[model samples]
Target: MVYIAGEEMTHYATELFVDQWIKPYFDISTWETYDLSCKSRDVTDDKVLHDAVEAGARIGAIFKEPTITPSTVQVKEMGLSKAFGSPNGAMRKGWNGITISRDTIHIKGIELGYKNQVLFERHAVGGEYGAGYNEVGAGTLLTTYLPDDNSPPFVVDKRDLTDDNNVVVVYHNPYDNVKELAHIFFGRCLEHKVTPYIVTKKTVFKWQEGFWSTMKEIFEKDYKDTFLKEGLLERSGNELTHLISDAATMQLIRWTDGGFGMAAHNYDGDMLTDQIAQVHRSPGFITSNLVGKSDDGSLIKEFEASHGTVSDLWNDHLAGKETSLNPLGLVEAMIGAMQHAAMLDVEKHPDDASKLEVKMKVLNFTETLREAMHNTFRYGQGTRDMSGPSGFSTEDFIGKVAWRLNR
Candidate 1:
């Protein structure tokens, strides 16, 4: 397995996150790592992203700390060759990944933490994020694709503009990629044993209608029977109904019994997942994992915290001030990668008792890791951001987890 440490406070926090898990469970130095830090990404021209993605597919799993996606200002300040694209975006394309699984944190006996549910956002191949565009003064733009020597250019969109109007054209293909995303969505819902809802804005964007349509067909044609056999859909609609993206947003906020699973297009997923994070608690409460299965039978998986690189926390750290940054999302991602690695091993050697034993160990460790994080809350202790009875610094918080696991 590989773990990538991104820039900023995450740059530092990820080190501790990794330390907390590996020292107790396995040889700390045995884990493979690549620095996807901003400076590193610039220096290496994002070669690390490719290396990490390739490693994830080959090794079956990767865990990552958040990286700062650079803007023009950041590019100049860092003195980079060029503004690097999102490391997350590059990894997604490299692996043909589906949506990152978003789940809320739940703290027991406390009415606060959000319920656990999966947000299955469509991600792969194309979207607004990866599109390249340049500012234009005045010109007519045409989109074209030519198949071969005998073919003519097939134009998609053409527009003419005056000097007063500035425009950009970027294209994204949600065609073939949507199928993989849909399969993953339905499969994950079944795995989690929850009603699954696919949300889309069919009215606004007819193309996105394809997402809802294709997903519906796949679920009914392939997964419905199995879902019924498992007795998974409790609602009258079997929880497989389509909701307008708008309505789905409301339900996410309204549902009390933990709105089990939801699938959305990439943009909707990005927006709604963050909203869930904020309402549920901090963004730290959310956990994410990106995955895809190749035709070659390899599962390419990348696990990461849902939140961004904590720039503010990085500032505090740089100032040599003790900060209480929440690394919950990052730590949870590591746990996911570990458990997935164990599961894959068990699948390979089903009859091997040693493999089963290791799987159990990883699982037990996952439980302890989670409990340790919550244990702080149970004991009226936490980071300053958590506003607990007494706050602990980042090191102290990790120490608490280590202490609990050992004790």
Candidate 2:
């Protein structure tokens, strides 16, 4: 397992969680660690970020803390070399990430929202997130496609600008990785017995047709038969379905009992998941996992809390005040990383009795930790975010979880 440490209140909370909750039953001292805090990234000129991604792919699983992507003002505040971009884009590109999965977390006795499981898969690369743009003044703009395969370069688009100041943006979607994303998304849905939904704005953005078409093609070839046989999409008459982005949003709100999995392109996914997170109480009540493949075709999974560092809580902590910072998302992420590592070990040494024992032990630990965290909420003893004015502080919340685990 690879542990990528970050900055702020979440980091402090994470360390406390691991020390109190994890170290008791499991030994994490052997785990590889990388400090990805702003200072560390600046000191290494962001090389540490790439190195951490490489380590995650090699190690098979990574648990990451939320880190800062310094802005121009933040660069001056932190005295950094330059305003570095988000490490997420680089990590996703580096790991050949296909999809990011965010599922709603539920406690046994508590029902905040979403009566059923809602699994969302977002295509983790390309779209507006990777677009390149430049300001232009009344001039002919030519967009060209230069093939590296010795083919002649051709003009993709040519526009005559009429406005004084305009912007030209260039971006592309790759058809190659869409198949991998579909397989992952559909496979998980099938595994969990949920209806799979493909969402896109293909009608408006014709360019997005490629994504929907590829997903449909792959579903027909690989998953449609099983989906029909299992009657998973019985509500849609045992047929796969595609929802326009707008309709998908409407359905997400209307269908509060979420027994479905939806996959969308990068931008749509980003927005939709935010909605899903809110519907499920908060981002902390969501589980985030990025599924990818390395160059060797081996799968690499990275887990992290969907929320950012709790800057407000950290400030309070610095002022020597108690804070009720919730670490549910971070704890769940750690459980995912540990479980993935254990599964990888079993896969590598399937016949080894010792390996099987280790896998079982890890699995038991994860299951127990999950129950303990949820039980904390079930007993009305979580952090203030979830448990209101009478809630425990951050330390007290974790300490309560630890006590539950031990008892």
- Candidate 1 residue runs with Cα over 4 Å from true position: 113-118, 137-139, 148-153, 160-163, 225-239, 347-353, 387-389
What residue runs in model 2 are displaced by over 4 Å at the alpha carbon?
Answer: none
Residue pairs with colliding backbones in model 1 are: none
- Candidate number with greatest lDDT: 2
lDDT of 2 by residue, 1-407 (tens): 99999999999999998999989888788899999998899999888988998898898899999999888888999999888889999888888888899888888778867988899999998989999999989989999889999799999999899999998899887668888898899999999888999999989888898888888899999999899888888876677788999999999898888889999999899999889988887778888888889777878999998888989889999999989887888988998999888888888888898988988998898999999888888888987767898989999999999998889
Q: TM-scores for all candidates?
A: 0.89, 0.96
lDDT of 1 by residue, 242-335 (tens): 8888997888778756747777767778888887887776888788888776557767777888888888877888899888887778888888
lDDT of candidate model 1 versus the reference = 0.76
The 10-residue segment with the lowest total lDDT in model 2: 233-242
* lDDT (C-alpha, whole model) for all candidates: 0.76, 0.89
Per-prediction RMSD in angstroms?
A: 2.8, 1.5
